[model samples]
Target chain A: MNYPNGSKQIPRSSQKLNSNETIFSNRGMTLEEDINATNDYYLDACLAVIHKKPTPVQIVKVDYPKRSAAVIKEGYFKQASTTDYNGVYRGKYVDFEAKETKNKTSFPLSNIHQHQVNHMKAVINQGGICFLIIRFAAFDETYLFQAHHLFEHWDNQFKGARKSIKYEQIRENGYFIPFAYQARVNYLSIVDQVYF
Target chain B: MNYPNGSKQIPRSSQKLNSNETIFSNRGMTLEEDINATNDYYLDACLAVIHKKPTPVQIVKVDYPKRSAAVIKEGYFKQASTTDYNGVYRGKYVDFEAKETKNKTSFPLSNIHQHQVNHMKAVINQGGICFLIIRFAAFDETYLFQAHHLFEHWDNQFKGARKSIKYEQIRENGYFIPFAYQARVNYLSIVDQVYF
Candidate 1:
């Protein structure tokens, strides 16, 4: 079926996670809402024009109450989006994906979708700035990894390499996004240093 | 209410046509979708990196079949969005709004939303490329009006000037984006000449 932006579902409903896969325990809110609020704060401060794309919810059913707000009652998880956040910066196009996990040792490969990885690679190939903002929420640390490096690791994984990307590997290959009061995730500073 | 980003909304609810209103008739497809397809052509040819943000729908109800997909059967129109298209080119961010009218003589100021106007101003202030692509479907003509000139006129219209911009005014204030076999709209060429 059709999803937002003509996204099609993957036929293979495959997963490495078992029936008892950790259900992504987190603080209080969904990782998406928190990152969205943070991005909103960043946008409000005029430190960056970045904004998170809407969650690609597959709207399967809805109830439009007369003179009331529409309430979503049923839906399915869509194919994870192609990009999490995108915006323009200093006249250049900037695009990225963001994810946070409570895992302490490494980020699980299952957290990312194949389509998103493909999209990030395409963005970089087309000469646009593309990266990812990865968070170790348990440690409260985040890093911005350029798309090229992500593709390298992702490709390696496809060839039967490590299933999880280690924290040390990220720290070595990724650019740490410096947190400022204004731009909470000031990925652009790193973008300037690396991609430009 | 949310729409992806830079996508416009047509208020099928409120439309008032005056004698001076410009008219543009198309093949019954959404201007947004058509432009999206056009942008895709541009992207494939390495001409531009633009996209239409998903149509923001405030879904109220959904239904999930046991083995089927979730369907959005009820929803309401979302608030008007900021712009119609935004992307990167040559390390620069490009942002713009697109509108089409059936009137041949003039385009109505009412076609634009206040928040979108504000967004264009902000983009300009932040040094991003901002503009409006006005298409007169009746005449099959489209022109790119820089946010600077549009803002000046839009602001003046609030005081006691033209409520609707004349076709001659658009010709004078805007640059024409040439249509091409590869790039269709070829908007980046205009961006290259004007913004870059």
Candidate 2:
């Protein structure tokens, strides 16, 4: 199994933890947390200016009480039209969506939406860096799969192809993103090697 | 007064409307709506992939019904750390905040926040195209003011300078954006001339 910081050994104290709990507790973070921490590191070092867009919520009603801030009384989550994380890196527009799946054999297409794919296509057409960060939690592995490569599978799915990308195929075509102490998901390294 | 689509005359039906009401009613849209429409035009034409980010909200409670979608019970608007709109344009990272002021004489510095300035500073340092779209509603004029020029005024406010940028200064330093039929706030025209 892959370990964070490239350390193969698990700490002795956590050896008794349940395997499922260990997936998160051992890593001390989820995929979202890891990416956020990495983005913070990138921002602090003046290396990039990436940020996760706020969750889209449709506000229906708001109450403005005297001497208090406005409070939303009714709201609902809205499906995002674009990727979750996006920003500028090295003068290029960078955009990507991060996902984590527990499946060991493959990454399912159901986790993504058509609009997000369409948005990624538009970004690519405009010459932006676009990709997906897929984490196979069962194996504790994360991969940076470029948008163009994903499009091939995404289109083939409608023509009697598998609804998911096999883990082996991902290993062959995607860049394995290594975890670091501070920058947990160092996807920019892959971007540097593949795009720059 | 400036007219949309470069027509000098106001429509006969709108001539009798109160001048203040005409600012929005006659224009039939706010600065935000105009910009959103312009972005849509750009997106439809595959010219750019810019979008205004969803409003930031701090959710406190949510209710999941038996069969219906989850609904947020309590939420509060959060001050955004970055600019309102950001996306890719001509293979470059573009970031900007749009603001409209009814004040005829100046654009107040108080309309902006320190954190946003810091965010814009970071974006500019990353070699991205950064600017502000300022709409002086009273004058029926909109201008594209580069972020660096705004930084000068933003910094001066702390150094015993006026807290507002005079209208004349903006007219002299900013590029006046023309209004089009479909692309109401055709700020990209100014972007092409100034940045490209």
Candidate 3:
């Protein structure tokens, strides 16, 4: 499909969509797609106003054609200083990052960055709800792990602890997010339970 | 200055800064630079956690060289579907759009998009503090116009009303944001007065 700007969509192998099936049943859908669909549902339902931030890019050069849109000729992605998703839910500020791991036993700390952890710490310090959405794709299980819980594990690694959070530990400490037809990754349910 | 990605900063005439003076006295600074500086101050002061969302880009092609980072070879900017700035303040959700106009008599409705208006309305409905930071560059004056006030002017344009809001009307309805040494566009003071 082509965007309004005349640029065609760059299809990713994991994001292939089948016309016959609903997004909720599209088992091959990546974690980002599910969360975006879920956020759209939440917006339409007036439950929340969350959105995935666009990828940050550093533009080096652009060419403005006579009558068409300006095209970026050179650009590079920048590391995001904040989380992937944030919004207001029930009059409360919410912020979170989502990650998908194929590893069967653990969610690696390498999936996150120190700057992101610092950002989340600042969010929590300001009284906002902050967390991570970790999806173990092999088991099709997604868990909502609060930021404070992740921080403890994050700091422990610097003290010679394991570099990843074990799946069993996540299962014990994080809330499991269930899939729904409308809200594919229904994380707000977990937010409602833990925050409110 | 060159970014970490090796992309040199594109010189914007209005954003040129002198090494001799602080940003507060940089009269030529655009509204965006002022707001960004203000946000940085707020972050360091532990007062707020707001950020301007990155410009959305529809990347069409990327080149991943052997040793360096991926380079976007072709891309087009996409219109954002939400307001520019958003974050948490005192545990409350805050969202806004910033626009600078050279018009002396009025602020044109065309400065904003319909989708942004819809997004702001949704945010207000969710009890988030939503507003517009309007700067009259000609007057060197800025005002924090609440989203609901903007909605009236926005909807009236479709009902055979003026296509722009009169300067006098904005002066009456919007809170004037005073410039400060640290907070160039000190809008949170208006938020504290109006919402808190």
Q: Tell me each candidate's TM-score.
A: 0.76, 0.88, 0.88
Candidate 3, residues A1-196, lDDT tens digits: the string is 1111222322122256678855444368999999999999999999999999999999999999999999999999999999989999988999999999999899999999999998899899889999999998887778889899899999999999999999888878887776777888888877877888
| lDDT on C-alpha atoms for all candidate structures | 0.67, 0.86, 0.86
Off by over 4 Å in 3: A1-26, B1-26
Query: What are the C-alpha RMSDs, in order, of all predicted structures?
Result: 11.6, 5.8, 10.8
Query: What are the clashing pairs of model 2?
Result: none
lDDT of each residue in A107-156, candidate 1, tens digit only: 88787789788667656766778887888877556677778877877889
Interface RMSD of each: 3.7, 0.6, 0.6
Best by TM-score: 2
Better of 1 and 2 by DockQ: 2
| Clashing residue pairs in candidate 3 (N, C-alpha, C atoms within 3 angstroms) | none
* Ordering by TM-score: 2, 3, 1
Please write out the lDDT profile of model 2 over residues B1-196, one tens digit for every residue: 2232433433232346565663432155789999999999999999899999999999999999999999999999999999999999988999999999999899999999999999999999999999999988776778888999999999998899999999888878887777667788887877887778
- What docking class should model 1 receive? acceptable
Docking class of 2: medium
Q: List chain B TM-scores, each candidate.
A: 0.80, 0.87, 0.87
Per-candidate clash tally: 32, 0, 0
Listed per model, the TM-scores of chain A against the true chain A are 0.73, 0.87, 0.87
Q: What TM value does model 2 have?
A: 0.88
